[model samples]
Target: MSRTMIAALVLVGLGLLTGCATSKDELMPTNGMTMQELWQQGSSMSAGDAGQQNIAATRATLRRPITSADMVEEQTRYTREAANEIHSQFSRLPNPDLVIYIYPHLAGRDQSVPVPGYSTVFPLYQKPHYAMPGETARPPGRTR
Candidate 1:
């Protein structure tokens, strides 16, 4: 009971403190000067003309376009050899596709909906077979 009473008092005190903080609606004046004017006054006192010029130069540098020259790491990531390896590493083995042309037919349980003539494709194998690295039997056209 005492713990519950203490929690309730803490909550009430917090509520009163927040209410007091929000009660005043007027914005505090900075000696009749705008907020931007006050910030300019402070910045002028802390930094010299050279420091301000350096900031302007930094802003100009930030506006430049991003390119390969800006890259910090090695440039070997997107080379031709890397691209070829990516394509050849997990190549699927030869699997001939069988296409069957279906004539226009009405297909429905109750309503006879006419399906347009279309060709459906099915792989000769049951599932895709990826060639193992350094396998004895590689795909026909693969030079490696």
Candidate 2:
């Protein structure tokens, strides 16, 4: 084997090895929480160690009685926070398209499902309205 050919092969081997040495799983959930749990924890997390606590509090709100006034206020607050978080996150994400699917279910059989099991193949998503005037609301990375 020629010296030039051997050196080229060695360089290619080193490049392949270096690429495989990098870990894609660098980010992991803290406090021993599963990745599934963390993914469903939503985006309104506190900027402190109280993130888990905030998740619990949010879940509690889901069970509260919804009076007219309460519903209005709660929906307003939730919409605002959710929008800000979505904008911030989507700005950094590669694709901004959100695909939502809602599954059909039998009537009056909501309790027959197993615990922590998802029965619906498609879920409903409520979209919030955002108003942008003139060219100020142009999307990123595109020319008008």
The global C-alpha lDDT for each of the candidates, from Candidate 1 onward, is 0.74, 0.58
Model 2, span 73-114: residue lDDT tens: 777755746555555334322223455444543444675554
* Weakest ten-residue segment in model 2 by summed lDDT: 128-137
Residue-wise C-alpha lDDT for candidate 1, range 1-144, written one tens digit per residue? 699999999999999997778532355535678889989988987589888889888998989877776563345544558656644665667788999999998889965898899999999999877777655246444633
Total clashes, candidate 1? 0
Best by lDDT: 1
Residue 81 lDDT (model 2): 68
lDDT of 2 at 20: 84
Worst 10 residues of 1 by lDDT: 22-31
Q: How far off is residue 129 in model 2, in Å?
A: 45
**Model 1 quality (TM-score):** 0.30
